[model samples]
Target: MATNLALDPSLIERAVEVSGEPSKKAAVTLALKEFIARREQRRIAELLGQLEWDESFDHKAERSRK
Candidate 1:
């Protein structure tokens, strides 16, 4: 999709320099992907210890059957 936004030129330049991306679009795409992955990791981290475990479930038995 073709979209336009007023972004900080200095920040974009810094991103390109630090990321070593050849173009502004590449830098922005990499930044967006990293941002999304970081956010998803944080979300998954928040779920830690929130799930119930089945104490009676035998993993060895299941593995042996197969």
Candidate 2:
């Protein structure tokens, strides 16, 4: 995983400072994880109200079942 790329130095510095990571690699890792989580959350958000709900379903009855 020893790859190099032309990344912005200022952005990297800001990420390190804001994330309080000890090194650029740590900051980048945290940024990538957060980016992935945010994208997944957005995808889930987009699914809101897209599922069908049964009005006759009784949650209390289901919970009381042995």
Candidate 3:
């Protein structure tokens, strides 16, 4: 599969240099994959945190049941 994306040249160059990949394409692919993985992990954590019931909510329910 082939896709065209326009990325900053300086950023791409930095990724290639740090990755030490033989080609720019390889560096870009690796960088993009890592970025996506990190972003997804953060999003999942945020969602999980939001789903958890707060202590205040639990206390309120206990009081109401008394």
Candidate 4:
């Protein structure tokens, strides 16, 4: 998909610097990905203390065994 956008030059410069992305496109992609992840995290936060877990399972031990 091709879209034409008139983005601010300074914003692009700052995004590139902060994100460490090689190009404007990459910086924008990273920004969007992070934004989506943050939104998803918020949704997950809403589920906190509402989910059931196995009391006997040690997640850290399983990962170490793997």
Each model's TM-score, in the order given? Answer: 0.81, 0.85, 0.60, 0.69
Model 3, range 1-66, lDDT digits (tens) per residue?
988888899998999999998899999889889999999999888897568576566766778894
Leading candidate by TM-score: 2
> Candidate 1: where are CA atoms >4 Å away?
57-66
Candidate 2 weakest ten by summed lDDT: 1-10
lDDT of 2 at 3: 90
C-alpha local distance difference test of each model: 0.98, 0.98, 0.88, 0.96
- Model 1 clash number: 0
Better of 1 and 4 by TM-score: 1
- Residue 45 lDDT, candidate 4, scale 0-100: 100
So what's the TM-score on candidate 2? 0.85
Worst 10 residues of 3 by lDDT: 49-58
State the lDDT at 22 in candidate 3: 87
Candidate 4's TM-score reads 0.69
Candidate 2: list runs displaced more than 4 Å: 60-66
lDDT of 2 by residue, 1-66 (tens): 799989999999999999999999999999999999999999999999998999999999999999
